[model samples]
Target: KKVELVTQGEATELDKSLVEKITDPLTHLVRNSCDHGIEMPADRIAKGKPETGTITLVASHQGGSIVIEVRDDGRGLNREKLIKKAREKGIDAPDTMTDAEVWNLIFAPG
Candidate 1:
């Protein structure tokens, strides 16, 4: 699948220490977005989307805090699959959990 990366607020500067701390995790998120978030070209086209997937990274200031966001135009999460995988990994994933809660299971230790 072909993916395009778009970065916004590239000039938004952070402290060197903070940048060092966030670099690895941010890289991980970008990599995961490319590997798992974006779908194949054919699948995207079949879903009425463009053949090329888009991944966007934005950085900005909100009051005193800096916010970074990563977004992708792709088939998001599969709720059923997430729940099943969590359960398979011995993580209790009750159906009553909210979508946010279920998605957080991705960070749980397996």
Candidate 2:
């Protein structure tokens, strides 16, 4: 039996058209997470963490807006390479911004 571990909003609130379009993209993201994000069994053992890594999906309503989150205890964003790439692309990423802001540069188009 499948059980919903947690949810805080109406899952049906999603726009039907957009939902249908994004379903495959969402599935691909989850599958990619399983394949590339989560470490292998042997690697986890070597790292001294649990053999099986965990991926969590969260949904909620906040300030009258829906929120969806997919998270994992895996390798996180690479900041150094991101900043270097930004410079290479001629993006003037001021040093005042935080690491999180620098990381967002990766999403910016060339």
Candidate 3:
């Protein structure tokens, strides 16, 4: 079985240069959804999720700006795991940090 892709708002218009610029990042994001974000079929079944995961890409005009989003049905980010990893990497992740802060640790350098 393979992961499914659901695209929406692709009909929205954007500058050709902007679309071209975002292509690389969008490709990386899609790869990430498959490789590092979604769980394997067995793992997903164990987690009580559908065996076939879904990745959604949406691009739209919002508030006069082009908005793009990539979402996935997957194992999802773990707050504790991220925090622990950050600390192990000496990234100064405090226990009291909020979930939002914990997730942002992925942007930090190792």
Which model scores highest in lDDT?
A: 1
TM-score between candidate 1 and the true structure: 0.92
Model 3: per-residue lDDT, tens digit, 1-110?
46999999978998899879999989988998899788889999999999999999998887978889999998789898898899899888889998889889988886
Error of 2 at 83 (Å): 2.0
Better of 1 and 2 by TM-score: 1
lDDT of 2 by residue, 1-110 (tens): 11122233446377779679877866775665676677777777788867777767666667877677766666666677777788889998776769889868856888
Residue-level lDDT tens digits of model 1 in 2-109:
999999999898999999999998999989988889999999999999999999999999999999998999888889999999999989999999999988988889
Write down the worst ten-residue block by lDDT for model 1.
Answer: 101-110
Deviating ranges (above 4 Å) for candidate 3: none
Model 3 clash pairs? none
Question: What Cα-based lDDT does every candidate model obtain?
Answer: 0.93, 0.69, 0.89
Q: Once all C-alphas are superposed, what RMSD does model 1 give against the true structure? A: 1.2
- After TM-score superposition, the amount by which residue 57's alpha carbon in candidate 2 deviates from its true location, in angstroms, is 1.3
Number of backbone clashes in candidate 3: 0
Q: TM-scores across all candidates?
A: 0.92, 0.65, 0.87
Deviation in angstroms for 90 in model 2?
4.1
In model 2, which range of ten residues has the least summed lDDT? 1-10
